[model samples]
Target: MPRDTPPAERGQRLAVYSHSDKRVVLHVRTNAITHLPPAASKDFLLLCPHQGVGEDDPAGSCPRGNTCQYVHADLRGAHRTTPHTKRGAVAGFYQTHLPGSRWLVHLPVDGECPPKLAILPSRCVLVTRATPADAQGSLPTACPHFTLRHRCDRGVRCRYVHAVASPPESGIQPGRCLTGGWQNDPYRAVPVLQSPEFDLTEHLPFA
Candidate 1:
């Protein structure tokens, strides 16, 4: 028997380690993500543009530095689906500026293990254990202008919506008509035929 073992170790019960028995691992997070281990490429899907940007850069456009300003992680799927599902694989990790020294990660691994904004062990595995089927299906919403014009000027670069808008059930048309007064203009109006339709030629300026 080990000398450290107390009288309880000699009993039939197995030895157990409590949460305090484990060593607390601390990870030194940085803003520079270029040097980090190669993981999934889900940056474009992230709503928070600041994921790959520097801590001081609010625009999220500056070049990558030596440390990460946002939370970053490698996520897999949990293989479950629910009506509330809204995110995809791990997109990033961010640290809170509060005094509690909190950390957060984005996206879920599978439908079951959805990504949550919670504090986790700093030294925990970077990659989650999930392989989602529709992992790459998280697309941004379509812009309002996209609904009127089928073609979007911003194309894929537009961060706004890219989907179609549902028509209102009230029957009242939404948005101002682009034709405006042109539809009522006499010069631009189509010529009305006699007999077949009410002859409006009398009102024509050339009549």
Candidate 2:
């Protein structure tokens, strides 16, 4: 009679699959393989209930509205749908103050899942100013055409500078300057330290 191996030695060793990091179990008797499911995490995508169903009711369809906790559907594609929860029908809607800005009333949607918004950090461009001491060196000048009308007639040939804005230093919060005027007002030009000089005739049609 063959001697029985110890209880610990009788069981097959569990191996981990390098690609997926999931544990694989091997049955010694049948030579069968089984993979254990990955652990559940909050990072998983949360599908909206009203998705793929139809257009959400304009009056009110989702009870959570802006307060829905799970991730929302994408807004850019045709498959996108306004998020609506099945808990209770109230209103299905979502809105943001600015493009890429945080949701006004939404919470978890900003921090969790598909429509994650809170992770986006505020950014601004730092325009370098010309000083008398540095007149000898070449420096970038803000494009007046781009600043006033948000377009440059010269395109790439324009001598003016077009600086890309970015987030400020550590501990420094980024915000719009409302000192000169409301930044959102379309009629008024954006506030700036020094306005660039340009010929009025260049922009005039008859000139």
Candidate 2 lDDT, tens digit per residue, 1-207? 112232245344221111111111111211221112234222222323433222233114446655544323322111211111111011111111123321110001111111111122111111122111135532233343343333333333444332222112232222334444423332232333332322122221111
Q: Least accurate stretch of 10 residues (summed lDDT) in model 2?
A: 103-112
TM-score of predicted structure 1: 0.15
Cα deviation of 198 in candidate 2 (Å)? 23
Error of 2 at 177 (Å): 20
Residue-by-residue lDDT tens digits, candidate 1, 1-207: 012222323333211111121111111122222333234232221212333211233334424433533323211110111100011101112111223221222211111221222222222212222111235633221233333332233333443332212222232222222242223431121211111111222222121
Off by over 4 Å in 1: 1-142, 165-207
The Cα error of candidate 1 at residue 48, in Å, is 41
RMSD of each: 27.0, 24.9
Give the range of the ten consecutive residues with the poorest summed lDDT in model 1. 77-86
